[model samples]
Every structure is written in structure tokens, then in C-alpha cells.
Target: MSNVLRIALVDPNDSTREMLKAMLLGMDTVWLEADCSRYEFFSDIIEQTAPDVGVVTLDSDEDRAIALVERLSKEAKDTVILAASESTDGHLILRTIRSGAREFLTLPVTKDDLAAALGRVSQQKFGTADGGGRSCEVIAIAGATGGVGTTSASVNLGCILASDSRNSVALLDLDLALGDADVFLDAIPDYTLADVVQNISRLDIQLLKQSLTKHSSGLYLLPRPVELHDTASITDESLRKVIGLLKASFSHLIIDLSKTYSPVDMAAIEAASRVILMTQLDLPCLRNVVRLMMSFEEIEGLQSKVEIVVNRAGLESGQISLKKAKETLGREVYALLPNDYRTMVEVRNNGVPLITQAPKAAITQAMRDLAAKLQGKSGGKVEAEPDKSAESKWKKFWPGAAKS
Candidate 1:
């Protein structure tokens, strides 16, 4: 176990302060050193408790929050200040970040997010001497278009990764309005990502784990909100914070993204250690892949991290060949998943992974192979036959593209 982080809570509202107090008490890794509802005696309380972390709620009064953060930075230089608010507005976040707040958290704070923030704070204050050299790998999965198996690949890959006893995995459904990662796992979670974000001020790892729906295979899921209207509440800052928290808590963070390329989606893709661009072997999908790749190339250093995953690899005779896909995308195919319609349908209906339903199936083996490759256990790479003609045709998509 890592060293326990000591924290003090300061909030104006009685209900909000108590909620934060209760959340702190529930977490084993964090100790509530002091909790108060007034800013007047916050310095005295900090001096008394000597907490490692200070959590100041800014939802009621941003001025007070800013003052408290600035005061703590000046007086108790050793203590790290974390500002909490309900607002995801860029201006407010910028203000808090500028005012010496080590991290800005949206209210209804989850345990994972808070813990992750503390871990970063701890590392900054005490270096790796206390964090035990902890780190997390974030993998984001995106589809070229719909029905390309992005969610399925994310869920199963998470499951496979979690199957290893040493690895702790979390599958985050970032699709927001239309996310169905829970449906694939046959889980009806009590809490969704919206619930966590709305109450981010009070979130802790213990509370977060309670909100997550844990599968039998040890994969924890943070599903998308049920109400479509709730999706509007999810802001890019909050999404980034949530992803940060997930990365802090889980060893392997697998994100299932939607088709749309919103700011939040871009943030996820940008933060990912590897972005699995899932696509089918079809003309439309291939064309879309080329376009998306071009977009990614515009963002510095993202193109090299993208792994092209060709799902339903051998589905039909007339579809785009592997050679053509490599030629069109100008990247090596990372992995190929077989077309197992019956197994996929059965697993989807039953809400289980192919590994559990049909472990002997070729699709299952393909997923395992993918997992192994991702884990760097296998050196095998899919080599495509040279197709200079296809390459030239695809290059026409980017008119002014300079050769790297």
C-alpha cells in the first residue's frame, strides 16, 4: 500500500462540507485531518492539522476559494491546495489554476480523481519518495465510423487485460450521450459518469468504486449517463479530470469513444498512450481512416501513436484487402480481428466477452493476440504486401502534405 495522503476540507455550506467529510472518512488512502465551513479560521485549522492536502470548495464563492488557495500557498507552503467548483467554464478554471491551486476539480469529485490529483501533488511536493513510482497507461479506442466494433474491442480488451492478476483495468465509456459499454458487459450501474461529475467535489476512490459496476472478471466500468440531456453537463475540463482520475486509479485505462470528434474526444485521443483506430475493411471505412489520419497528423506527435486495427478482417471477399488498407493508411496494421458473427451476437445479447462465451473461437484468440501485442509480450507484426499504386491514390487525399 502507498503512503496515506492527509487532507483538510473547507467548504461554506454545511451539507457540502459534511458530504466532503464523509467522503474523506470513507477512503483508506486519505485521512481527513481537518474540516471546516468557514474561511476565517482556515489558517488556524491548517496549522493545527498540518495536512498534506487542502481541499477548498469554490462553488459558493470563487473569491473566497481563491483567497484560501493563495493564503495556503503563502503560509503553508508545504500543503498542496486543490480547488473545487461546480463550474466547468474556461475562465473560472483558468483563474483557479493561476491562483496557486495545484488542481481544479469540478464538484461531486470522485475518489479516483481526487486520489489522482493528490498523487500528482504528492509527487510534486515529496517527489517519488512516497508514491512508489506509480504510473498508469491510458489507451483510447475510436472507430472510423459506426458499427466498427470500437466498444466491443474496448470492453473485451479491458477484460483480457484485467484477467491478468497483476493488472487493474478500468473501462471508461466516453461516448457520453450514446455510450453503451455497460450494455455490452450486461451491467446496470448505479452511478454513471454524470453522477460522478455532478458530485465531483465529494468524490473519493471509495465512493467512485461504489458508483462503478464491477464485472465478474474484475473489470470496473464508468458507464455513460442514461439521460441524453445529461450529456450536455459533461464539459471538456471535467472529462479531462475524470480521465486523469481513472489513469491514477487503474493500471490500464481503456476509453471507448463515440464517432463524433468533440473537444472531449480530442482530449482523450491526445492523452492516450496508444489510440486504437478501429475500422472495418470497406471502401467507406478506408476512406474515413485516411481522412482521420490526416487530421491526426495535424496534431503534433499523435500520428505515430495511432494503431490501425482492422476489425472483421476476413469478413468478405470483395472488401478492401489488408494490403490496400496499409497502402491507403500508410501505417502498418497493428492487429486483425476475425469475423465471428455468431459469437459476437451471442456475447452481445448475453452481455459477456467472447473470452468467456467462446474462449476457443478465433475472434477470442485474435483479441488475446492483440492484448499480448499491446503488453509487448509478442514481437509479431502484420506486414502488408507493397502496393505503390494504392499508396499514390491515397496520397492524393492530402494535397500539400510534406513528406516526413
Candidate 2:
């Protein structure tokens, strides 16, 4: 048996279908199942190969696409089917999902959308990025409370990976208007995320990549719009499509989600392979994290994927210890990043990652440790010790998660 996640591509256009297959195969770790267009051929290969995921082109005719989804669902209940079409109607997209498509996209197929869809499929099958074999990791950075340094963590982490000379990382600022990722990177993109979201139906990997600004470190950044109101109403559906595209193109995909929760942010959260909830050691931050932890625990398949990160951990002491915070929130603080004033200002002034500015700083070292963990390194000294008493508290707080 092949050791890769088998993906079946179904599109009639020879170029489009082959291009999709080739792009996926370029990953060198994915197994391409039989490519077919005709309904009969598709059914045959699907039964014979038993692909992990399905990619079917949505016909101009809704009835035809709906019928295809229905038939595929009956044949492979466990398999996820992703649909693609040439239109970007909200009603049509919703209708397809309701009909049984796990995901939807518009063509000429941007690499970003394709990647996001594949990432979703990978997550659904394997649970986490680390659980899967040879797939990109989707890490989302969000704040438990506003201004907890989620954006900075994401930006610096992305920069570190991009500059490591080992992997390709793409940084996405999903904050829409208030996003400072571009400003921090000192990049003023001529094209904002508005171009991709508004023109998603016509998106392709080439155009999507072209829309981004490449840093000297080889990091690709997708910045939000300069005017927040322009994209405040952006839908989760649109965000998923774009993120999916990025996943297909980059090995390490980092998302800087908006501080406040919205449809766009929720979509990113759901699609995240792992969510880093940033917080500080303060009463309000702890309280908010406790509440947010409850919500994460309540949501299916979200609890185990969330990683609590305490930024500027040593900045304030005694307001709350890591033990008390974990006890209150019912989760472990996966990483503790210190505050270094000089490094902070340097990053702010230069619009680059702290690792690039002061790689030896206390804060940068903490980030490097976190990144190493993400890359599956082990035996490194942990900065914070696990609180034993907090274990019972967490179990009581989230019985289901504890039981699982």
C-alpha cells in the first residue's frame, strides 16, 4: 500500500485536471489516485482505490454537481468530497455544502484554495498536522484577550521558519484592515487580501502567489486590506478558500487571526491544525482564557488542538503564576515567551522578526523553543514546569476532554 494520503482528482479539462494532479504530486509525499472525469470512471476508481479524499469539479449546472456529491457520499461515507466551480455565488456555495460537499472552491484554481481544501481533508482524517504524513501544518495565532501578542508571535515564527533555509513558510494576516503584518514586515503590498477574496472565483495558484509580497527571507505574506471596512463582511467560506490555497503551496502556514471573534476568525480557527491562544499573566487575561477554554472544550474537535501560549510571561509576576493560570483556565501553557524591550523595539522599527533582529534575546529564544517543538524536536529543556495540582482542576473543568 502507498504510504501517502490518496487524493482523487476529477475534472474533465485535461490541462486543469493534470495541473491539479501534478501540483499535488509535486509535494512528493501525496499519492495521486486515479484521475477521472466521467461519472462511471470516477465510481470505478473510487471503489478500487479507496482514496482518502475526493476532488470533483462543480459543473455549471447545479443539479449535476449536487447529484455527483450525493452519489459520492453514498459510495464513500468516510471520504470527504471537495467541490470546485467557476462561480462565486454565496447561495451556490452554501447549497453545495448542504448537499454533502465538505468544501467548495471556484476556478481557475489558485494554489491557496487547493492547499486549504487539502489541509482540511488532512486534518479531518488525521486530527492534527503532526498526525498526518507529509502535509503542511496549519498554525493559527489568536489572542485570549486583545493585545496579547498573537500577531507578533505569528509574524516572528513565520520569519524564523522562512529564514531557516529548511522550510517555506507563508504568513497570513487575517485581521483585514487593522492588520499590521505588512507594516511590521516593512512591506506595503500593492494588492491587498481584498483582491483575492473579491476575485476568489477566478483565483489560481499563480495569481494567488503573484498577489503576495515575497520577503528577502523567502516568506510569502498575504496582507489584509488597508481599509478595514472593505473586508469586515468577509465570510468564513472565503477565508477557508484562501487559506486552503496557501496550505497547498507552503509547508509552514502561519495565520495571524483578528483579536476579536468574527465569522472570518472562526473559519480560520476551525481550519487551524493547531490554535495558539496567546495570553498574559493577569487576572483579566486569565479570566478571559478560562472562558475561552470553556468554549474550546465545548466545541467538538477543538479542545485537543488548542495550545495556550503565555507571552511576556516574566514581565509581571505574582498577579498570576503559570500554575494558577493553568488551574483557572484548565489547560497547560505550551510555551512562555519573555519580554525583551530592545528586541521588541528593534522588531517594531525594522519590520522584521525578532529572531532576525536579536536572535539571542530572551524572547527570541523562547520563540525558537516553541518553533522547535512544532517541528517535533524533543528533550529540550522546558522553560515552565507542569503543575500537578492543576491537572485535577483541568479535568473538572472539561470532563469530556479529560476523559478522552
Candidate 3:
């Protein structure tokens, strides 16, 4: 087990606090063993736990939340400050931001929202040492458009790289408002990223470990909070601080960026060491890729770092050709993956990597090849050409018999 990402929560309501604690406890990597509610009690939790992120719900008096944010950010220079509100008031939200709150989520938090926020917090921590000293490598994965298998790729790749005997990897889901890494992994976490934002003043490795979901294969996941409203609870600065912490603890950090760009996503992209841009043959997907490529080029240090990948590259179903795609984008494709339905479906159902279950399958082999490519490993004997047509085998094995 690697170092944990410490977090704190400060919701006035006892039930809310307890619920948040329980949710955080579900993450095998996060240790929510401490609770600091009272002002006096908080000092002790800070001294004992030394959390890396702090989450605090908005109080009746907005000043308290603002004060908490300022104090936490100063006390824990690297700590991430997350502020939560029951109502969405523009004024209060702005005030929270002005006060140094890094993240903002509306009331009634969900699992996905929490995961994404924490994932950002964790990834930001990566690439930098404790107290923000050392520089490290950070990887960001973004799909050309929705459903381009970016999330699946990011998760599986993180698992593969982290599984390496010599390296430690952390997979962060940065689709802050609507990420689903937990569902994919079949994990129902007790704590969402909400807990971390509520207590930014005192964050430490032990507290951080208590917030992450660890797999049997040693993959650490920071899922997104399920509820959209919970996104308002976090701020951009808070997100960056958390990512810094992640860089500090892990050797490799993989971030899955949602199709849509937001302040949070842009921040992750800016901090990334490499950006894996995923696209398919469809025009819509290709167009988006072009736009993102153009946009990334404008950002400092991104033009030369973007890597393009053409997924489902075979000429069977998709309309666009590799030559046309290259001509249109003016960039060579990094890697190609054939459309293998059976293995992909199994992966969707089991939430495990295809290589782990069906290593010999074409899709599995492609993923292994992709992993090697990402690791910059070349000269290995590539697997034989895959039977892309074998996907039809599953059609005949459908659970329900179709009427002729």
C-alpha cells in the first residue's frame, strides 16, 4: 500500500458528517479514522491526523466557511480547501472563492462528485514533493468526444502501469461533476471526495489513504461524485492543491478528463506531463479532437506534449479512414485498436481489464501493446493480427433467443 491522502469534513449536521465519514471509510486507501468537529476538537485532529485535504459545509454565517478556507489554506499550504453549500447562491459561491476555497459543491453530495474532486486533489499532489518541492511526471487522458473509451483506457492503463513491480501508480477520475469509476469497479465507497474538501486545514498521508479505493491488484482509484450539484462544492485552487499532493506520493499518476472542458479539466491539463488525446473515426469525434488539439496548443507547454490515439481503428464499421484522419488532423496517429466487441463487453460487465481476463484476445493484446507504447517500450515481438471478425461469436450466444 502507498501513502494515503488525508482529508477532513466539517458538516454541522451530525447525520451529514456521519454519512460522509461512512462513505469515505469504504475507500480502502483512505483512513477516515479521525473526526474533528468542534473548534477545540479540530486542533487535536489536525495534530493527530495532519490531513492533506479539508472539507467544510457552509454554515449559517458565510464568514465561518470563508474563515475556515483561509485558515486551512494558510495552515496547510499544500492542503486543498473544499466548501459545500445547501443552496446555490452566486454571491456566496464567489465569496467562498475569494476566501481561498478551492472547491465548491452544492448540497446533497453524490459518490461520483466526491471521487472526481478527490481524484483531482490526488493527481495535483503527484509531480510535486511534500510541501510542494519536487517535480514528477503526470499523465492526463481525454476522449475526443463522449464514449470514446477514454475512462476505460485511463483506468486499465493506470492498473497496468501501477501493477509494475518497480513503480507505484494512482488513477484519478477528474470528471469532477459526473465521473463513474466506482461503478465501473463495482465499489460502493462510504466516503466521497466531499470529506476532503470540508477539512482542508489538516490533511496528511494517513488521512489521504483513508479516502482512496484500492483494488486487489493494487490500483488506487479516486472516483467522481455521482451528483452534479456537489461540483459547486469545490474550487479550482483546491483542485490543484490536491493534484499536487497526489504527485508527491505516487510515482505515476493517470488522470481521466471528461469530454467537456471546464476550469477543473483545464487545470489538470495544464499540470499534466503528457496528454493522451483519444479519438475515433467519426467526424464528430475527429472535429472535437481538432478543436482540443488547437486549444491545447495555445496553452503553455502543451503543444509539444499532446499524443493522439485512434481507437477502433479497423475499417469495418467506422466511416473515416486513417489516411483521411491524418490529413484532416495533420498529425500521425499514435496507436490503433481494432473493434473487439466480446472482450470490451466483458470488460464493461466485469469492470476488470481485458488483458487480465482474456490476455490472448485481440483487444487484450492491443491494450498490452498500447500500454507498452505508453511506457515507451519498443522492439518487443508484437502479438499476431487479431480476429476482428470473431466479435460476431457473441451475437449467436445472446442470453435471449430472438424470434425469426
Candidate 4:
């Protein structure tokens, strides 16, 4: 029950078994059911456990592995056979296929690739997003530009979502070097994101529950690595694996991403069910929005999920008008948050959420409305009406999202 995948594996070479074990352990969904070095014992183990998936490393002994795969395919018809080898030879892959292996992995298996391959098995079996029974919503919050209140939106929105007693929410600060999500909640953590990835082999739902810092609002937090040096170990693959695991466990996964257009950010964005692009009414922020939209256009299916929200609206009379901003961007603005600098400053300093600290403030109400909208509820005051075409129509996109 702790993990979705109950995996039985066989590796003829004992030298590579430990490496394979570490990679599989790091995956959030994988549970090592039984690992054996002898091919003769693998089928017996698979029959006894009837694991969800069976993995066979072929490089150590291709003929033996293929024979095992063929035997297991018949003997354990319920379990799917997954083959991996350091060799990328087409003939070898064909042999695995002919022998009844359902999937093949080019070896030197990365944690990400390993996780993804196993995930496919789970998906093929369950017909859900992952092996985990639940399909949680992943919300990635990005700034139109730095200092435009993206992080603030992420923090408050997460708190609002977690306020519902039925919802299990996890807030991830993915800014790496300068993330302050933990500070925003006023919780000091004994563990950080780096700790999870570094010790991935031991990661499970129970262990994850123990590692995350829980707030009074019932929101769980996994802040960015405390030391800047720890950020280096957080690869794009590791991040995706962590995010996938969180998605399985929580009802809502809120990610606060950095302004850097790094692979790490893109990985999170790709995993998200919705991307909240936070902007202010300013020339600089608008310009960045244009750039980001154009960039989003290049990626498949990325532009459609983006929901543009104007943060700190009405901060200055001189700022851009919502109408003009929509005309400039080619998409309707989704929501607008009022300017409440003093309230926000107080909330952040006290390490409390806006809803809890300044519940009656206008901005707090706006935040609640925004949360309601995201939660599939009505009563959101700020919207450009229901426009289904807004997401896909790129013609005349603000300054045109086309980079050419």
C-alpha cells in the first residue's frame, strides 16, 4: 500500500544489481518485491509474489534473460515483463519483443527513464495517470517577471486549497537558490527537497509523510534545498520523479518555480495540470509575458493550460489597463488580485497565510475567489467571460507570440 509498483527484478551480473536497485529505489512509485542474480530463480519469485512488473537486465546474459522473459510471460501472465540492457542493438530489442517482453530500456538506466518505463506498465494496467490510484492536480506557479508576486500567489493559493478539510495539499518551493516558501509559512524544516532525492532509495509514502513539514492549515511543505550547493543534485529527471510521487500522494501539488528558464522549470511545467502565469500591470512584466507565451507556443500543448492572472492589480493608476493588457496578450486575463502591500508584508513577516492573518482584506477575498475558480467553483469576480478559443488563438497574440 505504501507504493503502487510491486516489482520483481533479475540481473545476472551482481556488479550492476546495486546500481539498478538504487535507481529503482529512488523512484517514488517502485517497490522492490524481489531481486535475484540467478535467472533460474526469477520466474519462481515472480510466480510467488505475482508482482505488477518484472524487470530483466539482458546485457549480463541475453540468451538467458530472453528465455526467462519467455518463460515468465507464460508462467506469470498477469505480470508484465520489462527488459533493459546497456546495449542499444536493434536485434537485441527485437529478441526481447519476440520473447514476450512488453517494454525495453536502454541501459545505464536513469532514475527518470526507469520511473517513466515502470509508470507505463502501471498505466497500461490501471488506465490511470500513474500507478497510484489517485490522479492529483499539479499547479505550477510562474512569474511573468520577478517581483510580480508569483511566489505570494503560490503560497496563499496553496493555503487556501489546503483549508478544505477533504483536500490533501503539498506545497513545493522549486526556486532552488532563493526560494522562501518555508519562510512564508513560518515553518522550519528538518528535511529539504535535496534530502528526498539524495535518499530516494528509501522514499515511500510513509517516509515522505515524515520528511515534509506540515503547517497548521494542513498544508505539507517541501522547501528548496537549504544550502545552495545542494541544488546541483536536483536534476530535471529527479524533479519530475519527485513531482510525480507528490501528485500520487496529495490532492493538490503546488509548485513555486524560479524565474530561470531552466530545464527544471520546464519539467515541472510539463507535469502540471495548470500553469498559473502571474503578472502585474507593468511594461516589464507584460514584455516577459509575451516572451514566455512565444516560448510556450514552441512546446506542444503548453500554451493551452496557461492561465494568466494579474497580480497586485490597481497598484498604480499608471499601470496598464486590463482591456489593453488582454489586447496585448491575445488571451483573456483569468483573475486579478488587488494591491495590499502592507497586509502582504505583515503576513510574510509573521510566516502566516493571508487568509489566516488578514482574512477580511480585499486581497484575501480575491485570493479566495481565485482559489474557488481553480477548485472548479463559481463566484470568481474577475474574468474576461468564458472564452474557450482564448487559449488556442495565437493570431494577433500580444505583440504576437511568434518569435519570427
Best-performing candidate as measured by lDDT: 4
Scored by Cα lDDT, where does model 2 land?
A: 0.76
lDDT tens string, model 3, 156-193? 77767766876667778888766877766667776666
lDDT of 3 at 377: 88
lDDT of 1 by residue, 231-342 (tens): 8888888887677556646778899998998998999999898999999889888878878877886899998788889898888676877876676666678888999888
Candidate 1 lDDT trough over 10 residues, lowest sum: 126-135
Model 2 agreement with the true structure over 291-395: per-residue lDDT tens digits:
676676667999777888888877755567877776666556788888666678779788977877887788888888888887778465454554557656655
**Which candidate, 3 or 4, would have the higher lDDT against the true structure?**
4
Q: Rank the candidates by lDDT, best first.
A: 4, 1, 2, 3
TM-score of each: 0.68, 0.65, 0.61, 0.68
Point out the higher-scoring one by lDDT: 2 or 3: 2
**Local accuracy by lDDT, each model:** 0.82, 0.76, 0.70, 0.84
Model 3 C-alpha RMSD vs. true structure (Å) is 15.8
- lDDT head-to-head 2 vs 4, winner: 4
Model with the higher TM-score, candidate 3 or 4: 4
